[model samples]
Target: MIWLVTSICIQIICAVHVIRTGRNQIWMLFIFLFSLLGCFAYLMLEVMPAYWGNRHLRTARAQVAGKVDPERDVRRAQRDLELADTAANHIALGDAQAARGRYAEAEAAYRKGLALGPGNDWGTQVKLAQVLFERGSSREALTLLDGVPEVSRGSEWDRRGLLRARLLADLGRDAEARALFEDVMSRIAGEEARCHYAAFLIERDDRVRARQVLEEVEQRARRLDRTQRVAQADMYRWAGEKLAELRRASA
Candidate 1:
């Protein structure tokens, strides 16, 4: 009696769920006619996949939506900040704001992240300096970079190095910037750095070496894997343009 009642209850619950889900009428028929076996089939074939698929889609959509409407994240983070102004959270918001060209807001958020103490002081400074650099605050940007204490071979190092190199070039510290590029050549593994070095060489009237470097950059760009190619698409194009320019100049 107990077993029979339990089977009926399971079938009824699954049948109503399937019906409300608005799936094939066949599912309701199977549930009503086949009982527990039908419920099991419905769960395996429809319920589980629908649940998991919706989960993945929700996660993917949220991530994509963040990029689509950058301000949406800012608002969400602000709400969180109202309750708990954690350093990590502030940095995340700052990053989003920075990506959207809201440098002032990003700067404030990064400063708050820094003041929150020990969230990610090094990273926060790098991002803040990036904003300052974009805004033509070169000296301030350099100061933040100089305060970083150490420079190593990592994505962070590449970022700081690129900014530092550009600052040096803009301030007419060509020698230092060229030397920095040479250092970067040893540390980084992309054609873009070489392209920058080639430009510096071109500026110095070393056309031969510049041509050689550009050719090498072209070869390297051609050899990049799919992931690297995506990462260096702009650089690849720049190097190709530089190569063509060099050729015409030589011709």
Candidate 2:
């Protein structure tokens, strides 16, 4: 019974994908009649080829690989750095170390990258600031942020602003932090910005607003595709747990 239900769900999702992507209507029929097998065929024949370079697919693949071998990226990055010691290689090592929560190592890697003159000076500086902040050097992080060239748009801009907001909050500049968080939430569409903003509100005892933000996360989470859901599983889990905690508090 469980297998049948799961197959039906996959068939429905494949049918929806076919319609959305304007694939031949035959795929809908194939998916419906053949169910899971047909869906797998459709994915391999159509979806995978078309979306091989898609960020979501790459992220999902990375997430799965990371789970299976948590230090895989770190190992690869270290090997590359040892072979070339290029700025890009150093930056990559820093990113891998940061992902693994080794902030001290990440900070050293980022500084070495910066010393070697990374291609994106502002971005590398921001990354260094992030690791420094994680290492509890909030004031040094703030200094690094202040030194970077101001970006007015794109994901990099959002990340810089968000980090600055968190730094401000930690430094007891609540008004500045709140304003930046609001600005970031207003400009971004993803659950990360919403979740971070919600967390900020919760920290300040603004449960009503936090609950509303978290409910929005839940709504958007339900609408995400499999790849997107996998990439954002951590944020979604945090939002769910926070919501449950708030509910318990109210009870």
Candidate 3:
């Protein structure tokens, strides 16, 4: 009985760890079926030695690295800057800098790309708005987003609209936020856009609509092109989990 309890505990821990790490669902199922024995087998076969060799493991000979490699970061930043011709490169660099929490650097990179004469560069404008929003300039970000003309409201623009709607909601302009969300949903037809819109609806206590939106997103994600399917998979998975949490809270 004691061994059985220990096995169950290990299985639970392994299941939670797999979920947290976003491992493949098939592997998760296998671990669930075999319990602790399966988890032990997985650890022995699947987990990379390099991952266990990290400095955090006192048993490992590797020493903890001091800090992030600044040289590599600088080189990557420079390479991104060099590639900033069209709007996409600027958007990519802005995303990278934003991920690194260098908001000012991201904004500057986006603005420089915008200034390079790509008329009606909606993506660049949107990225700038995002950076501004992150920097606590929501009003300015809204103003910048509002300037995006209708002609630029293509599939890629849906993300900008969603961001604008979210900011509006944050500022307590619920009516405007709903309007923008509805507008974007009407025009956009992708899993990513639907996932974001669903999140907004769920926040507004509209669970039925949110669930419908998420269902559509799931369907669309399954039909997306290879690259887009991978991207949309992550979005749908997150949206689905958040939707479940919201439902539980309401319950």
User: By descending lDDT, how would the candidates be arranged?
Assistant: 2, 1, 3
Clashing pairs in 3: none
Candidate 1 per-residue lDDT over residues 129-170, each given as its tens digit: 888877788888888888886766697777678779977876
RMSD value for candidate 3: 12.4
- lDDT at residue 51 of model 3 (Cα atoms): 59
Question: For residue 9, what is the lDDT in candidate 2?
Answer: 87
What's model 2's TM-score?
0.74
Candidate 2 lDDT, tens digit per residue, 24-52?
Answer: 67767668877787787678656775457
| Separate clash counts for every candidate | 0, 0, 0
lDDT of 3 by residue, 1-251 (tens): 99989888887887787678775445566577878767875565445464564333322212111121223444566786686565556666776677677899899878877887457877678778988988988899989988976546676667667788878977779899888887887776665557666777777889888877776665656676555554345676797687677567668
Give the top-scoring candidate (TM-score). Answer: 2
Instruction: Output candidate 1 Cα RMSD.
Output: 11.5
Task: Report the number of backbone clashes for model 2.
Answer: 0
The TM-score, computed over Cα atoms with residue i paired to residue i, of candidate 3 is 0.54
Instruction: List ranges where model 3 is wrong by over 4 Å.
Output: 1-74, 77-95, 99-101, 111-123, 148-153, 156-159, 224-228, 243-251
